[model samples]
Target: MDRKSLSLLILIVLLGLCIRLQNFGEIFDSRIYYYGYDPYYHMRLVEAIVLEGYRPSFDYYINYPYGLRIDWLPLFDYILAFPGLFLGFWASEIFAVVFPVIIGVLCIVLVYLISLEVLRNEKFALISAFIFSVCPVTVWKSLLGKADHHIWVVFLLLLSIWLVTKPGLLKLLSGIPMLLMALSWLGAPIYAALLAVSSLFQFNEKEVRIVGISNLIPVLSSIQNLFLGFSFLAIAVFLLVGSFVKRFERRFRYAIVYYLCICSVALLSAYLMPVGWLGFVKSGISYVLGTDIYLPTIREARSFQILGVISSAGYLFFVLAIPALFMLRNGFLKVFFVLSFLISILQLRFVEVLAFPVAILASYTICQILERVDYPVFRKEEEGESKRRGRKEKKKAVEIRKKDHATVIAFLLFLALPCFANSLAPVEMTMDWKEALNWMKENLEAQDYLKAYEKPDYAVLSWWDYGNWILYVAKKAVVCNNFQAGADDAAKFFTAQSEEEAMKIVEKRKVRYVVTVEELTVKPETNKTKFIPIMQIAGYSPEYMKNKEIIDFFNKTMLYKLHVENATNLTHFRLLKNFGTVKIFEVK
Candidate 1:
């Protein structure tokens, strides 16, 4: 609460802002350019909401002729859309680009507050905030132009945790953030599960009630259909009975019973309505655990290696974080850290959540080590004798302590340098891809492509990676996109053994254009090729690319003919544009 502490916290937040904004110039040429696949789709949705005043429940642009129901939580897109209500579309895009940075900076402040609560030391709290500010795991996802729900997920979850730690009225309102978290990300239920389990370590009635009630809102709202309605009513009755009749003498027993009851409701709902809440939760869990059949094809779903973790978290931070898990005094944080770390090892996307507790625990451990050191700067001056000592001696001690603080701060900054440096790079679509999509948009519009069902006359067929870009930038229909909806068909079309087989898929799906990236056809010198992943997703054996016969077969596929051979001699496909990184072909 002191001025110095407040000043330092402000400085730490500013530091995070600077790091997140480091590549802002590259992302903004004439206008804001988003950094990744999902952001583009979200921005597209935001524009829709801004102009239409509500998100269309079903979007015809994605998943081609079948279309796709918009299942994503509207809260994040709504947040971006609100700006457009006052400032129009372009301004909204600008706001969306910078929104993640604003959330990231706020998260830095929350980290400090939560750390202070758990550690009970302002010094350690400040260190934790500083650590999180530059932590690569968080910085990369929360950078400017990376306007995805992930940053909002981190912020709302952190806010919920910090709220739960408060006393009285503030504690009761904790459920609000948990509700917002649920609405922000489909993965929020898993976090609620973790929090419920953590309660067994340190049970708090208010915290449990807040989490339980907040979790129920999402489940209850999923009652539009008959089966879900019945399931919801049944779960509601069971919860009422349990609340009144289930009286346990022990707090631990109460915690266990409530947690199990919540699980039961989820299981029953999932059983009754496979297409509802449980399905979504299972999909999230499957994606995080890499249990989904197609998850390995997605880059963020890949398991993290030890070296990757170290690189993202920093070598020293990882080293301290592991021990700090045990050294941490707060039971909730201890359990949360272990759960997040274990899951993060399986899926890289979970690393951002893991960063929260890692910063706290690592900073806690650092403070412990520094405090235990024999150096005079860390040692408290003798109290009784200090009263008798001259003012000069006391002032000298203060000066030494100041120097000590500076030394430790310098050392902490040194530990954070690697993560800071790693967070500097920004990922965006190549200019070639951008120009190609722009050209596609202009040509499609010129051809009166939007006459039917408010959709383009034809769908573009591309790998799942470029689906969002094609959807958002080209403003066209797509066979497959970031949602992984039409990926199997895409894989089949691209890897089909013959142009005839590929044409069957294209004709079946009404795909008129095929987009190809060189990475899908050619291997990079230093890295593995996307062709292998495409092959894998299409059900090829792991070593298919290694076999000479299979490689020859792959060379004959529609993807190779289009991207590598320029569709030369191909009968039914015509090359439209070759933009080096991106290629477009029209099905004739």
Candidate 2:
């Protein structure tokens, strides 16, 4: 790379870092807390690896009375624990919080490299880097203290793409990132599927062989079921056979053969194992459509709305990204981009995955427009040195060039300002919940505290959203957690109208404490006494909250009594601490 290009890359990296870390103080203050529920669980796993030397096979802190198996991949936690190994637990926790910011910046650099390789233009590559730097969804997900595996998913996927673009054996090494990606997130299958399908269009045998082999590494190591293993194996076998087939002798192209092979395998599987095949297909469809029992209640699993994309990624980039896809020339990239866009539209959980593609496409469009501009005309000069020109002509030429430069700079900034501003969101858990959980940790006599995996004496009951926070922060067991393990009971416990009905669930789950937040009970801003999510999870109709009698009945339920009435009038519950917006109640 030339010095100027290198300097510009460095500047763009710095700008990306600045935008993501602008609220560093708020996120990593004297009392360090993570931004969301999942990060806390991730740090807890890191703590286990750092302190216990390994993650426990079974966790006693969540899904109380039955505990939960620790099935999450440990690679991401191991990466987080690397810093703690050298710096100690406290410093490592801080490092874990800051790790995503570093990865976020690395993603910006990877986008630049991939864009340059695909577009073969330095200017467009740099523009792509800048767009990704300020892309709001990417920035928000990778901000300080927002430590989650989703950012690593993006980074590893981009790194894998860049690696595959290299020549010779270097392309085979793409499997390393693919392997890491499989261990980093559960959605790695989406990427593997995209690559497998896109490779069919490649006329080069070497490209097909390398991508197929790279993908097989993940499947071999991570396979857990017979059906999924068989599915991937069939695809791999076809690719291996296609690698040796002579391109000229075939009546049909390899792409056609590959397509037919997949259809044939799918049909054969459906015929041979009707029940298992139907279940697999149904589950996949339900998850993407958000039509499943649990998924519809989770915020991130809901179907995407265009307004949400505009809100998170900005209207300007979203507008340009549509046409930008058509402008992208790389076949593999176009396939991956289109698939990601479609999946995101099906489920919002994949929305952040659009960051890299949207940024590159939007940048391509912007640069294309800029390249079409007509610069100021000047007299043709000699190649080496121009003859002495009149002072008047020289001054006029200089003025015109300056005006053109200013106009280009102004136009770029105008397009970037809104996106940069949109990327400035900072997320932090409520201080009230933090203090309450801390108080429970210090004052409550909940357990023996002998071991990390030791079961607590009792469990806390709350909506599933806060279960991870209660487990990690309060150092106690919970009836439900982010995994949706005990979601049904949690929903039943909170929505039960009579003390008798609520107590039955509490007894079944051995729950001694319940947590409530303002949004669960009453929030004036939305003009609802209870949030809709709890109702949804409880299987209540949407119209239930509308009727006056139904609303009155809700006012008498266990959740309402705990938060609105302070648990004072309830027979089996007593309010222990009330932090205005957040309240904790002790079950008798």
Instruction: Quote the positional error of residue 165 for candidate 2 in Å.
Output: 2.0
User: Per-residue CA lDDT of candidate 1, range 411-430, in tens?
Assistant: 88888878867877754687
Clashing pairs in 1: none
TM-score of each: 0.85, 0.87
**What ranges in model 2 sit over 4 Å off?**
223-235, 238-286, 289-291, 375-406, 446-452, 522-530, 543-550
lDDT of 1 at 194: 60
Tens digits of per-residue lDDT, candidate 2, 341-433, equal 777777777777677777778877777676556432112332113445323333333334667757866776677788787777644467788
Candidate 1, superposed: residue stretches over 4 Å from native = 204-288, 304-307, 374-403, 445-453, 524-527, 543-553
